[model samples]
Target: MCGIVGILNRYEAQSSSLHTSLRCLHHRGPDDRGAWQDEYLQLGHTRLSILDLSPLGHQPMASEDGRYCISFNGEIYNYLELKQELTTLGHSFNGHSDTEVLLASFAQWSTACLDHLRGMFAFAIWDKETQNLFLGRDRFGEKPLYYWYDKEAFYFASELKALLPLLPTVPELDPVSIDLYFHYQYVPEPRTPLKGIHKLPAAHYLQISREDWKFTPQCYWSLENIPPVTGDPATLIRQELEKSIELVLRSDVPIGVALSGGIDSSAIAALAAPKYRDTLQTFSVGYPGRPAYDERNQAEALAKSLKLPFHDIELTTEALVDFFPSLVAAVDEPIADIAAYGHYSGMQLAASQGVKVMLSGVGGDELFWGYSWVARAARISELKDHYLQAPTWKAQGIRTLRKLAQHPLYQKLGQSKKVPIPIQSWFRPGIDLSQMTLSPPDRAVFYELSPDFVEALTYRPHLFTQSLWEHIPLDNPYCLFPLSPPTTLDIPNQISQTLFQTWLVSNCLSLGDRVSMACSIETRLPLLDKELAELVIGLRKNQPDHCLPAKAWLKSALKGILPNEVLDRPKRGFQPPVQEWMHAVVRENLETLTTGHLVELNILSKSFVQALRDEFSNKGRHTFMLYKAVVLEIWYRQIVLSSQSAVRI
Candidate 1:
């Protein structure tokens, strides 16, 4: 894994400045750096030396003719296999590395070369023969690519900050996106907090031609189009998932797992143990005194169950305070998810233990219906009929819904779904009798969709609106209702699919790729492996619990191999006690920075900052926003307000 930055300039410019931008990403690759320039294009690379640790593996790796050079920022886990295939077809290589395979693959196949790749990647290859620059991200977007385009040039980077300097104009902050940052905790793609820059979405690629100085992005893959599954495919899915996990674990370096004691991580660790059983090492992080949030015991138990060496890091706010200056600087974004504090610490701890690569169970939740919001929405939809009756019911409904909004998960769903009512207001609209338009089965399917999914996941608003219109005419069947609430497993499966293809790609996975790469860590996700994603995606949606609750399939698969106690436990993702930690390091710094900036420069409203902080300190609500505001303010002062160059590493 590494950081890559480049420019396709309209005006002819030297590649020297491009080298400066790549140098700013030195933390991503202190191991090796290279720059290649043509009359109209410049590409730069910062190497992490994951595979072949040789000068041959150093990029900008190029064709022998030097007409085609490339800079890449992620691993092609199947590169070794692809290399064998390419060699069979008479392509010889100088180095035993993925970079050479990639350069050769592109040279042989062009953009179609992506079809042969099966790992996380974001790379740019410039073809001097055609004066075309092609950039592609992995099918799952486990690696990030951000780009900015204008009349003079098109610039791209693994992080936004690296691209900020190439622009002739100062980066503009989009206030609307700031509102989204406040709503979602992290800004969603393809918009960044900056106005002009955009994240290249997963499953997509962009091509820029120097002749016309134009760029266009197109999708090369889609999970949405996977054909439906047939009966008795359970064993097939299990086999496929295991194959994917094995494929992704094929690294030469010492590899470890980030065990959270959850079903997902436990499954990966358990499966991987025998492969590296005696040598396997695991890492977990915890906040002392926060038992409600700590999963260290569960993690340790799993490690013991697998008989692997286990290590735990108990972090204090003080240790984290020392870590954040560089951590924050590394990410170069206001990552409002406080859990990243623990992830950053966990990576540091892993690095210290001499582990260079770490596998995580990140995409599992999105693949399975592990998040509470899915079930919560299901519960709310089930109860809507009971409450959509009397005038008094409506009023009471409003009151209950308002209280539900106070919960962070509900509030987040509220934002994602864009519920019409205030979070505090609970009253859902009573049934509309315009027309009982749909058949019973279809009507039931419509009702199974949560307000959150209806509001958030349905991209074709017109189709969604039409689906809702059909539901308006349903007869009140409360009096003669069946014992169960239409328990088709397919519903949650569809929801899981939506979460993976839409929200997970946009939110968590995207965040992981950018943040970890910014810190120069090559984070591997076992659950997002192409074969695994395809397997899970191909599962019958009708059996929502087919994977069972919290990776039931994983537990069952590892049943005899892993201790039953370890396999049967609940799922607990990396949750950090950031509310308390922020109070220690960020609170005072926030006050000092915001107040001093407001007083000295007289730019922002001091009263607004004070109110934001007061709310954060008193209620711990919107503290996420307060954190974001503080980070943004500090960044503005350092980059936009100060006269000093913002390109420092």
Candidate 2:
């Protein structure tokens, strides 16, 4: 809900340019600004007034004895409770702001304070007593923190834009990050477009001291390792989710929900409307003529049923064309999701209506098994293990029978004649006997038939210029599965872990934080509560959490809270008029790519640009690839090329 920056170096110079760098994140915090510094450390904050709207909430707040100074972003939803506990231990505060309470808790417990905290946060605490600086991010990465270090000093900020200005020099373009972006739509954690700039991984805290002048990050949480708790998962999910909603709703400003037709947002709206003291407003967006992508009707009906004020926006192709460049700028990172226009516009609508805080349901799919393809991928991994583990003649006979009788290639015979129930278990698991020779991760990528992902896999070979291709190591991004998914967990849970690390953090939550913060709207996701995630991970330990029907566990939690009309509705993405929007944006910007920074910098080949023009001109066969190219092109022009003479491959 705010922006925090730190300039901690071993320099004694004055005029740190701290204020100039903090102003770059003006949209993140428009309400108030503050700064505090000494010879070696400078801290700055821009406040959005989510809690304690009065001036009493001003930050870069320091302790009574002045041992520690804290500049923090995001809300500690459990701050009030922590304040009461701290009060009992003789700690007092002048204001009701969470920043004050967090500072007091750090004063009392020091680094151990992270154990008692429960919310999204990325903060820097400067300890004058020890001459050390500490950087901490939340368990689920709800808040973003980026930093870069040179031999002289360390710089950290809430956004990449803020940190980029203060760097010693423009860093080299990270070729590996670019290659991963084309495959996964966003670069994964610990890697950004620049080589030295890094994202502090979630559930991590780093400490750098003048004593050693070393910045070492220590991880505090992991989804891959957790003891399984034996219980009915449905009851636990409902209980924890309700508590999370209550916690996130503790804001002083007017609050609203990002309501959609789907069960995730609808469930939040249903549970939050009555609990909210005021009329809970809802916002949605859709394309005007595109009914397939529009959810206004269903969203409106839910808003009416809940007696909440409903506001909707209609995006024409022209508007999306105009929004493209701005989208690239607002989302400072190069994320290829065009659906960002919807989230950005929705928050703009909320901000226009005097709404400062909004709640979203982004982690529903990853928590419960919402993506059917991911579920099938889990089963396929299990099937691969079956093929490898059981190779006896009898087992091979059953496998061969399952392949012939249950595979889709042989499904025509089953339509007329009934297939046995046992054999049906093998149906539609995305199996490939001939192609199963590859490793588990590679095989999953090979069979993944999702729309953008299918083209995402093979585009790098044809798209990258020859020099750039050989210059960078284009390791096969087994993106369909995960980034080093753990083996101790079940296959389904491993898949969920993969999506959480790769897709959820890199794509869903990354865009969620950037786009929403761009509008200065504080969006809270109750579905992605940390406790709920740990519980679900435990449930998947002995049993397959996703092996049930798709999102069955989540639907069970929402059985009576939401109507069957929504509960039974199939899963949907934040879809837009993809083909129409693609044509509008790609055609308008084709010339830019042909003569643009990407080719001039020798990053992309001329042949690839011509192929892109050909695709958009005639039929637009590779639409996602074209969109990725445009995203990188505009992002390159604005973020990379515009930065002074960035080093290239």
TM-score per candidate, chains pooled: 0.79, 0.93
Candidate 2 lDDT, 229-283, residue by residue in tens: 7888789888888998989899888988898899899989998988783757999
Scored against the true structure, residue 14 in model 1 reaches a CA lDDT of 46
Worst 10-residue stretch by lDDT in candidate 2?
429-438
Q: Please give the lDDT score at residue 429 for candidate 1.
A: 20
TM-score of 2: 0.93
Model 2 segments more than 4 A misplaced: 11-14, 392-426, 429-437, 440-451, 474-476, 479-486, 643-649
Model 1 misplaced regions, further than 4 Å: 231-234, 375-498, 501-503, 514-520, 541-548, 590-606, 615-622, 635-644, 647-649
The residue-by-residue lDDT of candidate 1 on 513-592, one tens digit each, is 65555545678887888776666666544344532345555555555655777665655577777677766666656667
Residue pairs in collision within model 2? none
Clashes of each: 10, 0
The weakest ten consecutive residues by lDDT in model 1 span 429-438
Give the winner by TM-score.
2
